[model samples]
Target: MTPTPIAEPLFRPEDAVPMSTDEADVLAWPVAAEQLATLAKYWLATGRASGRPHVMPVMGVWLGSTLTVSSRPGTVKGRNLLRDGRCVVTATTELGDLVLEGDAGRVTDVARQREAAAAFVAKYDWRFGLRDGRAYDDSLPGSPEYAFFEIVPVKGFGYGPDGLTATRWRF
Candidate 1:
């Protein structure tokens, strides 16, 4: 049987730009280092609507080009992504902040999912016992309930006390 196409947000190739190291420095300069650190925290919020866009903190990792995060089998965020296929993730340090808005999608490729999981473990090994024999692949393959998302940041913003500065990066 043919696999059904998963719903996803619309993304244009022209929108996939790369942010340079120089640009990162420039954008992250104005904010205080401590503030920037705090902003680098997990789970901010993403959605449209005037008041309070359901800020949910989530574990994330900066893989240079894109930020990857995993959610449990069932959750509001997972359900939201499955329905909308779009999200925004934000991280900030006392010195600066970064916001990524883009078309979010699940990583269906087994190898790619494993790689993303490994990267997440490496980034958060100190906080979570990721290598304590708990393998991510232990679960059955193609489990409809299992959810993992790879956020391809299309538009990004870096801001600080100085002013509104921004940078764009490829997912």
Candidate 2:
């Protein structure tokens, strides 16, 4: 889709050139369904209450425009998400890079949780539990409870490796 931004948050580092829809589509981004489906990992960046940055690689599944990820609540990453909803998730490969900037919230709906669980299993070859959708103990015995989160990008960028080109999408 040609980016008709719903909202444009400050995207990119200080030096990147602004992207336009009419230019060549070097990297088909804001992320298409096909690209999202196959991605093995995404880098998630969150903020602590003190405004410190917490970044880690996370297993995620893109369902429609929302990206779902999970972590055990006690971890730093989990705590960060809980305290602050804003985050940035980036995925890259030989094809290009996709950076999603938005606020992430806990997944509370059971149906959506189940859907996310299915997608998680399909993508990661791992299972958490059928006991619940949002958060649950590890599928294995005595595993710690894990929390789920969803991020719908308010602003994002898909760009080529070279500094000269990019496509920005906002929603």
TM-score of 1: 0.58
Using TM-score, give the best candidate's number. 2
- Could you tell me how far off, in angstroms, the CA of residue 105 lies in candidate 1 after the best superposition? 0.6
Give each model's whole-structure lDDT: 0.51, 0.73
- Write candidate 1's Cα lDDT for 1-171 as tens digits: 222222221223354233223333353222322232333256645553333355688776544344566775357676666566568877655545556676767667666666766665565552222233222433445432444576765655555444433333333
For candidate 1, the per-residue lDDT at 65 reads 46
Evaluate model 2: give its lDDT.
0.73
RMSD of 1: 11.0
What is candidate 2's lDDT per residue for 24-140, written digit by digit as tens? 454444334467658888899999888889899998887777888988878998899888889998888665677889888888788888888888878786776746454665766
Every model's TM-score: 0.58, 0.80
Off by over 4 Å in 2: 1-22, 26-33, 132-134
